[model samples]
Target: MSELRTEQPHDDAGLRDWQHVHNVIIPTHVLSLAEVRERAGRNHLEVAYLDDVLVGCSTVRPPTGDTLTATVIARTLPAHRGQGFGTELYARGVARARDLGAETIETVVLSSNEDGLRFAKKRGFVEIERYLLPGDTIPWIDLRLS
Candidate 1:
């Protein structure tokens, strides 16, 4: 893999990254640019690039108000899936969460997505809960950050 670069994306580029990854992973669940814009307003977003090309993105919505933990969502584009980009990005996400005093980091993976499941487990996350979505059940996995 080429040298990895990570950054907090700005405006339009951030929305595009969100939409692009959403479309790549879950085509049935598309997020409009406007929706991405709205989410960006509420979440911390980061994008990872390999050799200057966007390869993955990560978002973490830190606990606030009634919530006590953070939720992290990360995805790497198809072509860049298993070359360690996701893992690198996740490490940064966890670091950020720790800096923010978050006690736990939660991430969900579709039950059918074996790669995602393994990825989470490999990083010391434990399956803590499961929930049914429209057509699939997802496991809510978490890692202690504190």
Candidate 2:
């Protein structure tokens, strides 16, 4: 069975472990540990653990007036990917947003990231808009859950 654990952003050791997992799992985004820590410190960040092992993390920033912006950076250790860690992380994030009085949550994903899109779809997220990256023509999709 898997277990989920939630903690504040400044928990250095937890954030470091999460950063390592994220670096290995996400191909396009090369986020540094410092960046992850900074974001976690800015908003409500949650981490998930499975038997003392770090598995996933998510960051949610509640906006004014019924909306929340969330970015979930989670990675299951290579051996745990198919066990639903990602889904659990997302569920927790959405629940946290709702608890914070947000009626809607928004997320963005790269166009080429099929796995992410699939995960979002499974979590009841629908594409609401598409925009190009600043320096490139690569399209990114914005998904919303309401």
Question: Where is model 2 more than 4 Å wrong at Cα?
Answer: 65-78, 135-138
| Per-residue alpha-carbon lDDT of candidate 2 for residues 26-58, written as tens digits (9 for 90 to 100) | 555667878987767677776667778777666
Report the lDDT tens digits of candidate 1 across residue range 50-96: 77688988888776545458777778887888788888878788777
Best by lDDT: 1
**How many residue pairs clash (N, CA or C atoms closer than 3 angstroms) in each of the candidate models, in the order given?**
0, 0
C-alpha positional error of residue 76 in candidate 2 after TM-score superposition, expressed in Å: 3.7
Which residue pairs come into collision in candidate 1? none
Judged by whole-model lDDT over C-alpha atoms, candidate 2 comes out at: 0.69
Error of 2 at 89 (Å): 1.3
